[model samples]
Target: MNWTVISDNWLFFLVGAYPYGPLGGLLLTLLLAVGAGILATLLGIGWGLSLTLTSGHIHRLLQSVCEVLRAIPVLLLMFWCFFLLPIVFGIDVPGVLTVIAALALVSGAYLAYAMAAGIAAVPAGQWEAAQASGLSQRQTLRWVVLPQALRIVQPSFVNQWVTLVKDTSLAYIVGVAEFTFVANQVNSREQVYPLEVFGFIALVYLLLCSAVQALGQRLLVKPS
Candidate 1:
């Protein structure tokens, strides 16, 4: 519980080498999580919407893809992206990019399922009403169905985002130089109290995650 070491090296743990060099630590972690989550959400929404359409073959294909991705562990996906990608594609992607790819694939699968459920929860009468109002299928989805679906599933969506934030810690295994990685580096160097180092790192994660959950609750409680 050495506050001095923490006070001195806090910046390093928060943004490893960023002020002096490249951006790393919690900042990079959040960047990867937020970017991947946003991309996955958009991709998932598109896939989910397409699933609702009258196309059996396309629905099966997309559903299978989502299932396969969801079945794979994030760590295994990270390994595949880091090691196998270069062998298969002859391209050397950075660790950050590998993490982004893995998270996006995983998050997209879960989001697809969430969004499909949300869309399915919408009443058929709403769809009929939209159609009777002279709205095309696309306009109906955009103006009527999606808005209500999103509202209904917002709490779950925010939960997914929180999961995304926590999952960012896994990026450290691939040498992505995020918050956990920085803390590990510091802990290794300052062996005087390794538990303290890790405890502080845990605290940081708890604080950030709690803040996200608080915000989500506030949003969910707000009157529509």
Candidate 2:
């Protein structure tokens, strides 16, 4: 309705006070999502390998850790990282970094399950063949199992990334000033264009999520 509010604050929505000061808004949101996604992916891969490759106590410990992490809410994780860690550790961690840390831990736990499912999807025959070919377990995993697992789980990984992008909105909880935070700020200041402000950001999120879906489809297609 009130297009003027959107017209005035679009830059703030896209990149709040970038050159002028700290980065915020959609750009910062993307940056945080990307950082967390990368870290989570690496953590997931390591955890997944441990889950699939190890046995007895190591496997049970990792499984319990994943379960515990998964059971905890992301909001609670962020609160602990931002508010509790400082008091406990007596170290000053930046809000943005704390948000990323929380996101990565939560995302990593979920993606670890995805990675485990991917590893399990690998054919038993493949493992038998790898073992018969004089390869050790680690060698077979590195050379045979992981490659197939990664390919099988590409779409799932992309879906997790999309989820991560949306999850970055929670960064607003810790005063991280992401896209949602900027939109809320605009609404609070203008008091007249809540629909316009929120609608615009919703469209942005739709486009970003759609782009990620398209990328997943493209990557899934086999080359001729």
Candidate 3:
């Protein structure tokens, strides 16, 4: 309950020794989460849009891939990529890279489902109107349908971002040296106050997630 400990170690929690060395702690966590989420969103949008436009065979394949990825646990995915990827592929990937890849795969599958739902909810008339206006399929998607669908799914997308932020904690399992990892290291070193370190980590996560949710709400209301 002593706030002084947190005040004293706030820099460590935020960036570890990143200014003088490699990045670690909350900054690393946010970087991993945001980078993975952005890559996942791109992949998801492509697959989701393909599902709307492609033949049954392609749709089935995409659906199955998403299902498989969604079914796997994040921790398992991270462990598999961390250990097996190097051995099986002869690629010497770092733990942090593996964690980011695992998260991106998982996030892409979930986002595909969300985006598919959003696209499906768009009216058929919109498509017809775009066609009548002499727009190509790509043009319609870029300028019309996607814009509307994205707006409709803004709330759900924001929720997914929040989930991704929290899920960054799982990166600790793969030794990514993120916020949670740093806290655990601190806890191990200061064994007399393990609870205090973990409690502060929890508070940091809560604050970050809350800030994202608030920002999402503000973006929803502000004229775009």
Candidate 4:
């Protein structure tokens, strides 16, 4: 129950040895999550729209690919990105980028499905109304379908983001030195007060996830 461990290493949990060394810890975790989330959103939008817009073989192929990606665990994806890419493709991605790439792929797969569901949930009348107004398919989608679909799935996106933020803890597996890794290092060094050390990190994660949920709620509320 010693609080001094947390007090002493609080800065390390926030940013490990920055200004003197490379940045790590919670800062790196957030960077990876946000970067992956942004990339995932872009991939999700493209894949989601393609799922609805394309048909026959192309759509089926995209669905299979997304399903395969979704089936793979994030840790396995990180291993492939970190280890296999270098051997197979000869592309030596940095550790940070590798984690982000893995996270983006994993989150993007789920987001694509969520988005596709949202698009499907859109009423048939919306498409008909758009076409009746002399809009092309592309125009109709851009003007009518996507907006409503995105709105309907906005909460899902935020939830996905919160999940992604927590997922960044997996980055430590690939030696990314995120918050969990830093805390682990501290715990290893101290070798006492494990409860306080790990408890502090759990609290931090809780706060971070709660903040994200709050932001999502705020964004979901229509301006009065």
Q: Which candidate ranks first by TM-score, i.e. highest?
A: 4
lDDT of 1: 0.83
Report the C-alpha lDDT of model 3 over 1-224, residue by residue, as the tens digit. Answer: 55666677788888977889778999999999889878877877887888778778888998999999999998999988887878999878788788778888888888888788888888999989999999998998888788777777778777877888888889877777799887877777666777678788878889999988888777642326
TM-score for each of the candidates: 0.92, 0.93, 0.90, 0.94
How many backbone clashes does every candidate have? 0, 0, 0, 0
lDDT (tens digit, per residue) of candidate 1 on 12-99: 8778998787789888877887798888778778877877774788788988888999999998999998988799999898988889
Question: Per-residue CA lDDT of candidate 4, range 42-134, in tens?
Answer: 999889998888999999999999999999999998988888888999999898998898889889989999899989999999999999999
Residue 3 CA error for candidate 4 (Å)? 1.0
Q: Indicate the residue-level lDDT of 54 in model 3.
A: 78
* lDDT (Cα, 0-100) at 219 in candidate 2: 62
Q: Sorted by TM-score, highest first, which candidate order results?
A: 4, 2, 1, 3
Report the Cα lDDT for residue 108, model 2: 90
In candidate 3, which residue pairs clash?
none
lDDT of 2 by residue, 61-136 (tens): 9999999989998888888888887899987778899888888888898888888998999999999999999999
Error of 3 at 103 (Å): 1.0
The ten-residue window of minimal lDDT in model 1 covers 215-224
